[model samples]
Target: MLAAIVGRPNVGKSTLFNRLTGTRQAIVDDESGVTRDRVYGEAEWEGRTIPLVDTGGYVPRSDDPFERAIREQAETALADADVILFVVDVTTGLTDVDQEIAQVLRTADAPVMVLANKADNQEREWAASEFYQLGLGEVYPVSGTTKRGVDEMMSALVEALPEETDEETPDRTRISLVGKPNAGKSSLVNATLGFDRAIVTETPGTTRDAVHSVVRYEDQELLLIDTAGMRKTSKTEGVEYYASVRSEQTIRDGDVCILVLDATEEIHKQDLSVLTTVNEHKKGMVIAVNKWDLVPKDGGTMDQFTKYLRQYLGTLDHVPLVYTSAVTKQRVYDLLDTALEVAEKRAQRVQTSDLNDVVQAALRKKHPPSMSSGAFVKIKYATQVRTAPPVFVFFANHPEGVRDSYKRYLEGEIREAFGYDGVPLTLVFKEK
Candidate 1:
């Protein structure tokens, strides 16, 4: 379920990738190796989804050791990919290096799709015809900027997947701090590090790569991945599109995400899109409204903002929210405290005996509600099945009769018993 976009530098490989994935996850520049490492993003082609890797644009290097290492990384991407997108600039005719890539693709077990980008018009499209000589077959001349012939290209690519299968992913608690460009992500990291560890910059996109710093809070060391700024997928427009995809890797890697919103700007569609990525990851999350000092002393702006968040984010009502200014170090310490609290809660393990005690006690006070099936779920016992975003399983007769409201009640009771202030809990129903 992965496709690696490979080509020589400045061929618009990143641009084509960004256009397809609809994210600004990869840093694009006229300079080579601007994308120094592997960048990944979710790619949807013709309703079938897969991860798209924007590798560092390769240069024809059979000799340089550094170039060799980059080539190895690109080869690894090829090995891992379900399909390969070989992008070539229609503006520049194919070179020996392009043929070298073709030879590599011919040797690869994965299917290769030739994309002739920058073919903005029919004349350029005609110019793309020469790429057929590479022998990959059927060069699809398209424009990443204008998006011409993109649909056909995507359809052709989707049909080439081996099978519809979900791969087993690594289990890790991921917490992402996402916001618009220059939204104090680096400053917050500095405040948390208590030094100038993370390089702070006045210009945006300084932290190009996703930097992970492990910190201990309440005796537990947790990985905090500081991701780059994410813009709306629709407005991504070419290579900037890869940034959203690259930033999403942090979200996918985390068990929980802490969205850092700029308090100064009116919450735009882009911020919501970032949150949407967090939700799609299904990780426990908290929102840190950053740069709070800039906000005027309005009577109820905080309340209004909170209301808007809850209303828009819906069903994520349980997610926690905190406001702070990284520059002034206002409430910065509280952010870590809350993060630890949430992490511990996520890692909570409730014993079956303890769960039964709480559930039965609550049930005695208020009987398990009747359901539409005309049978009430008789809970015998409940226990924490897992930790790190704790998941609980309840053994019961007529488990199907259990309703969401009653489940919430049981969750509330458990929280009251354990005082999991910052963690999210998962409840499951099972027949005894």
Candidate 2:
């Protein structure tokens, strides 16, 4: 399922997005219209997973030349969504632009869910009720700070989803190190390989096209893709555009994407935008704070980095974060270790007997809820249907009512039984 989070400018959409994705994919600021492009992520609602999209904020009243382009982008996201999460500021009530957006969603033939955001308190939660007049069914009040109502909203979302299943697959893990110009992507790549195989240049965007090399570690061959630095879209012209396009294409092709960030400069909108693209591609991701040696060592940098990451890249929480100084080779190999661990987890496959046994044990520990029609939900069998990113299919009596929360419990059990570190798990509920 593909869910697009859309709303007017500065309604905390990016903040909520970071909370959900556990990433800093989108840049968050007091300024509106900062996010000029669409950002994407793969989000799992419990174990009923799906892709998520964070589009440029819709500034309905702006006269800026780019305003029209942003509107069109938002419209495109709406068109592509299996479901639309319409976010709104509960404290501010409904503005005319909000009404305009609601009207558009009303005409849209897609599944639309209204989210009353920033409802951090009881009063704000009550304030969210006014949005019901938009006619998008019940409004879900969520506080990105507290994470309140997020799980409930996700639970309802998973229940409303149609049945889907995954097929079996072999393990082929490819991890790509990617980032903007001069962000040290190549340095990180070389550090991972522990050799100077990848040429490191002082010039920005030195590495062009996709340079791929296979490195053997612990009996596993890791295909390391060192990509060119992606320039600003406006600066992307001729061969530069070709390089940027190829870099993005390479990111989508990889099983895991490691976004190398510069520690000296403040994280830019461009970096966050690239991250959004990675998440949208549904690739397991890790954010490496590259060039850590340059940081002032004022302390709290790691916490600050994580806080900002969570703030901007909402709703994507499955990614791993690492801090490394690629130039100093400090903790660089650790990043590779983490990447390999993630790759292994992503490529894992569990036996049918093991899966069934897990489900049986889970049910015995905590029973699933009864449906509204009074039928008890029963997971008859479960098995690993796929390996890449480790997708498991559950054969159940009440697939719809299995509940996202319960599915999360099952995934947790599977992880505990078989450690799938650094990888995202996908769970699909289907009838036998």
Candidate 3:
């Protein structure tokens, strides 16, 4: 079941959304209208994860383009929602906008629950009674920040849903193409599939949602995800802001992500930040330096550019990068080949005996560092605990004493021994 949190600007709707979904998907700011698109996340009640959408504040009329987009997004979310959480600020009392919104929802088929948010104190709780004049239904006082009255709100909301929703995972290799706006990600998607799956536009933020398609290459079927170009939150407005949120979901859920970068534009700060997010998710990745046709080339230009990229990758420098131009189809097949190789590496697992041998060699070369007290950290065997972004557990007497430098060393040794390249490696130190 889908429930949308709807209200006017600065009424704590985004705060309420975070409380319900237990996700930082929606950005909460003191400034009004920070949330401009319908951001979707799950809310857990009892044992079920209920789907929830955080929408922009609804306005009856607006001349500004962003505000108009917000109103349209809210209306679309309201139309699809099974329940509407009409959040209002108790401290500010009821306003004309609240009444106007209530009037529109009054005729809607979905049930409306007026949430009097920010009722953290007795006086504010009493102020909630003013919303009864809106005539929507019983007013439920809530504190989005404090999380007071949230449980009761969920209890009521669960009973209001039409039925319990269970989403099934589809069987396919999911690949997400992500990058900054106007970086030619959509064009890359078209080149890979040999057809236009997403609209390639000159304007930034043309693709509002993550476009999905099923394609085949070498008899292997995979899900292709072309997502919106992410930008700084401060620069994103209205629909573009929420589009980036959806792209994050695509990265987390995808098995492999091909990060597209424009060669002409060079790498930006936002590109590195997005890569950090992908690495955090521990997904297999390949960097596609797109629009290589635009870069003026010399005998050593490509070599210098590769070094520049490696500097930015830092600890993630192990990830493979391929220079390509979707317009000219330069190295396009190489991108897919490397991406598949990355996915294979993510799923590769080393046997326990091999892991222990590699760990022993690494330890013998450079012993464990001791704590400030000079008590030596014991060296022990290791095991591959899992795969799909392979995780290795290293047993030690003092897990806390193992520094970051040592961990990086172990990761390098494991990669050299097992050939799990182009994927993030997780090393966990624990006392056994």
Index of the highest-TM-score prediction: 3
**lDDT score at residue 150, model 2, on the 0-100 scale:** 87
Worst 10 residues of 1 by lDDT: 233-242
lDDT of 2: 0.77
lDDT of 1 by residue, 278-346 (tens): 665556667889989989868998898889877877655666788898888998878777766676576
- Give all TM-scores, in the order shown: 0.59, 0.53, 0.84
| Residue 291 of model 2, lDDT score | 85
- Model 1 misses residue 39 by how many Å? 13
Q: 150, model 1: CA deviation in Å?
A: 24
Which of the two candidates, 1 or 2, achieves a greater TM-score against the reference?
Answer: 1
Decide which is better by lDDT, 1 or 3: 3
In candidate 3, what are the lDDT values of residues 235-288, reduced to their tens digit? 555466557767877887798998889899857888988888889889988899
Error of 3 at 251 (Å): 1.3
For candidate 3, what is the lDDT?
0.83
Give residue 336's error in model 2 in angstroms.
1.5
Q: After superposition, how far is residue 187 of candidate 3 from its true place, in Å?
A: 1.2
